[model samples]
Target: MYVGLVGCGLVGNKRARGLGSNHRLAAVADKDLTRAESLASQHSGCDYFADWQAVVGHPACEVIIVATTNDTLAEVATAAIDRNRPVLIEKPAARNSKEIEPLIEIAERNGVPVKVGFNHRFHPALIQARQIWDTGELGDLMYIRGRYGHGGRLGYEKEWRADPRIAGGGELLDQGVHLIDLSRWFAGEFADVDGYVNTYFWRMPVEDNAFMLLKTIAQQVAWLHVSCTEWKNLFSFEIFGRNGKLQIDGLGGSYGTERLTYYQMSPEMGPPATVISEYPESDDSWEMEFAYFIDCIQHGCEPQGNLKDAKAALRIVEALYEKHTSGKSVRL
Candidate 1:
């Protein structure tokens, strides 16, 4: 398939590499022509444009990847869907749930496929964990606990992420959505959302820290926390079930080595049997996720991480923000 990528930034580079050898990046675009040109130069025969609309309308491009800022994600995606092009939008898909609602309607009306880039779902450890979970080895799920955070670099407050108009929200919308999506993936839809968001370190309008306590209709709980103030980068998710527990630690690279540890409870209680799996290789989640998106496009199937999933995550984010201001728990 020929791909058109909008946004020639860090994530855009990752998306380009994730195309693998089977697909070609035929067109690229960024507000900064030089950045687009630079990305285009890396892929032979790739065209560069300053206007994203041009990439969306490119004659040779079959699929569109929207890796632009939060504010423009829905806009670029809407243009592609309007042209009958499938889109793989970056996570958090929009500034808020409301921003993604219209895109959902447009895609459904056009029968266009749209996939949200929740690459973490493709992590090898998580994949194995899901297989184990599906086998019922974890028994009835009881609860989930997840914590993900990274320390911001010097002058980080000057980036687009620090600007509310551009980022929409702070750490919550940025990294918190990932955790929220993952939790929903494992446990199910949250029936109740009670959380708080605060700007602790970064002098930005959005919160630097977000804490959430979510519950399913069955009362199963998901305790999640996301922050940009951590001195050390970290990612940890633990799922507890009646028969055992699954704990996923790190995300490779700065977050440390990716590993999943499963504890199978003994009928006799006491110490349980432990199994650990580690993924020391570089992150291939982007490639795996892209491949699935392509498969969904060709098979005429819905992606696992579609706009609805993104909207669900964004709703949780919105609820948390609202709860913080209203001082009340939100019923979803």
Candidate 2:
């Protein structure tokens, strides 16, 4: 498959490398032509474009990947879908649910598949945890706890992420949506949401921290907190069930090693049985996620992380943002 990628930044580079051997970059685009050219130079026969629209319209592109800023995600994906091309859009998909709503409608109407980049779900530890959950080893799921954060660098406030108009809602929309999506994947639709967002350290207009409590109809809860104020980078997610518990820590790289610990309850209680598994390999979540997207494209099925999931996560984010802005709790 030939992929047309828009956004030749950090994520764009990851996407290109994650394309696997079966797919090749057919066209690459970025507002900065030099960036596009740089990426295009690395991939043989790949063309460079200054306008994303050209990549979307490129005759050789069978699939499109939109790795642009939050505000342009939906716009670029929509254009690709309009061309009857499948699209892989980076997470949050859009600035808000409102922005994603129309894209969903258009994609559905066009019968074009769109995959949202929720790559965290493909982490090795999480994948192993899902298998454990499926085996009933954890029994009935009770709740999920997730905390993910990173310390910002110098001049971080001057980046596009600090601009609400470009990055949407800050840390919540950034790393927070991954936690929200994972929660929904395990606990089902949330019936209630209670949370707040705040700007603790960064001077940006958006909040640097977000705290959330999401509950399913069965009372299964997801307590999540995402931040950019943490002096040390971290990622921790734990799932508690009636019979056992699963704890996942780190995400490789600066977040430390990736590991999962399973604690199975003893028949008589007391300490319980424990098993630990660690993944010391470099992060392959991006490649695995792109592979799933490719599978969806080949099998004529919708992606696991589609626009609907993106919209659901965005709604949770918007709810918290609303609560913080209006000084009131949002019921939904």
Candidate 3:
């Protein structure tokens, strides 16, 4: 199948690369023709256009991939849906819930499929962990906690990612949205939350550090912490339950880490819990998510990263920011 792509930034390029052999990058569009051309060169026979409208409306393209700035997401997404083309929009789906909730309606009315790019849902370790939980191997789940952080990147400036007005929130929206969505995705729908966000450096107009608490529908509480200020990195998840506890440690780090640990501790006459089994290293999450999107487009199926689920993640993000900026408790 021929797939059209928009945005020539980091995620866009990585996605195009991941698509490799199974799918063809039929067309690409970017505000900057140079970058668009550069991206087109990466694909043997792809066409590059300055305006995404042309890319989206191209007759040969069956799927439109919107990987641009958050602010421009809705416009491009709406256009793709309008053309009756299936769309796979990048994570967060939009700047806020106001932008996301409506897409569900638009998709239903148009009878075209829509997907958000929350690729972490396809992470192997995360998938295995979810399987463990579903099998009740961990017993009655109590709490889950994690952190996703890293040093800010240089390319942030080349794109609209550094600007709050265009990027939506800051690191909170960029990285925080990922952790928040994944936390809830594993824990269940969030029932309530409280959090804080701050941008201490990066010379950017968005938050650089963010910490959040999520109360899931199952009454499970999870802590999600993210910061671009960290010198190194940290990515780990701890699940506590009635049986004992299971600690899963990420190997590499956020965005690149490909390792996991599944050590469980059980009471043994009051002795300290011991490590049981640890998972071997795995694949890069970026590649995993990208491959999944292309597969969805090829076989004609709704991506596991559904629009409604992405909207749900964005809702939690919007609520956190609202509470941080307005000084109110977010009940939902």
Q: Largest TM-score belongs to which candidate?
A: 1
Instruction: Write the number of the candidate with greater lDDT, choosing between 1 and 2.
Output: 1
**Residue pairs with clashing backbones, model 3:** none
Writing each residue's lDDT as its tens digit, candidate 3 over 1-332 gives 68899999888997787565667999999999999999999888899999999999998898888999899888899999988888888888898888876788888898787878777666676777777778776677788888877776776544577777888887778878777777766677888978888877777677888888888777788888888877677667677767655555554435444544555555563643454444445445656765676566567677666788887777888888889878885978
Model 2, residue 70: displacement in angstroms?
Answer: 0.8
Q: For all the candidates, what are their Cα RMSDs to the real structure?
A: 0.7, 0.9, 2.8
Query: Which regions of candidate 1 are displaced past 4 Å?
Result: none
Residue 174, candidate 1: how far off, in angstroms? 0.5
For 176-282, candidate 1 gives per-residue lDDT tens digits of 99999999999999999998889888887889999999999999999999999988999999999999999999999999999999999999999999999999999
| lDDT tens readout by residue for model 2, 1-332 | 99999999999999999999999999999999999999999999999999999999999999999999888998999889988999999998999999999899999999999999999999999999999998987889999999999999999999999999999879999999999999988888987778888898888898899999888888889999999998899999999999999999999999999999999998899997999999999999999999999899899998898999999999988888877778776666
Task: List the lowest-lDDT window of 10 residues for candidate 2.
Answer: 323-332
Give the number of colliding residue pairs in candidate 1: 0
Candidate 3 similarity to native, TM-score? 0.89
TM-score order, best first, reads 1, 2, 3
lDDT of each: 0.95, 0.93, 0.77
